[model samples]
Target: MAYGYTGWGWPTGLRNGMGDAGLALGIIALVLFIAFPLAMILGVLALIFGGIGHARARRGEAGNRGQALAGMICGGVGLVLATLVLVLVVSTGDEEPNGRMDEGGYSATSVR
Candidate 1:
């Protein structure tokens, strides 16, 4: 019997394609976690795609179950990290500088 051959034969290319995309997006999301919001967005997408891939695999309609699982793992971790960063930033209130200068007009102390 062929290895990894399901009785119903191989699933369509699209099924595996989603798994591949999920894996790639998951990796990207993990790497971009430093970007906070963007990472959260990518992580969400990765999870969605991974879920689809996983469903197909569970139904014996596709391969790459490992990839789908990996995607889900990365997406979950990345999303959590991004959310923490966002929360920290919001709580810390790291807003832009007020950009107010002294009215003394080019004082020596200001230059120093």
Candidate 2:
């Protein structure tokens, strides 16, 4: 029975589990998740629409190529915007003082 059941030579693991639909939707979700949050108000519409498009593609109601492309574009833009904002904040922000400043006009004269 063991010798006759030699169907182990089949290339099953080499293929995908969810095929193109899964890839398309997954990419869209991941990209939008990264982009929308990073972009703040700029990528809000893109995220919303990209999500809808991905869903539609998964359902076979829309094209996946477009959906995936849009998602990547929006996500990239958002990420860049978010990075820029972070850089600006870091560059312009001041460090908190460790010690309190003296309100009195005490000069740093040498005391004997």
Candidate 3:
């Protein structure tokens, strides 16, 4: 029930909280899941926070270990997916001269 190093307090509770945050962060950092940057931010937070959480959990933090693990996983996945989506979006595209997709389709102006 202590915030910081209060000499002698419970690490379990703190760790548990940290773990939960990590998990939540991982989940957030996804596509159509949380927000754009929010997810990314949270995901990173989860990883860092989760690592600390689990470490604390090892020091007797109730459920921080699990949270940390979850955070790492989620963050990884989120990063991958986010990167993929970004790449796809960025790489996918420039407009054709006719203002249409370059899938080989043409307008009547071409026919004339």
Winning candidate number (TM-score) = 1
Worst 10 residues of 2 by lDDT: 13-22
- How badly does each model clash, as a count of residue pairs? 0, 0, 2
Candidate 1 lowest-lDDT run of ten: 94-103
Q: How does model 2 score by TM-score? A: 0.37
Ranking by lDDT: 1, 3, 2
lDDT of 3 by residue, 14-95 (tens): 4377778878878778543324456556667778877877887887746657768888788778876766666665666665
For each candidate, give its TM-score against the true structure. 0.70, 0.37, 0.61
Full ranking by TM-score: 1, 3, 2
Off by over 4 Å in 1: 1-15, 94-112
Please tell me which predicted candidate would have the highest lDDT against the true structure: 1
lDDT of 1 at 41: 94
State the lDDT of candidate 2 residue by residue for 1-112, as single tens digits.
5556666586533222223433443344345443434355444444555566566667766555464446546554665666666676666555335545543655568435
User: How far off is residue 79 in model 2, in Å?
Assistant: 3.8
- Candidate 2 RMSD to the correct structure: 10.8
Put down candidate 1 lDDT per residue, 1-112, tens digits, no spaces.
5677457776456457677788888899899998998999999999999999999998888889999989988988999999999998776564445745445556677785
Q: Clashes in model 2: which pairs?
A: none
- After TM-score superposition, what is the CA distance of residue 93 in candidate 1 from its true location, in Å? 1.3
**TM-score: model 3 vs. ground truth:** 0.61
Model 1: residue 100 alpha-carbon error in angstroms: 17
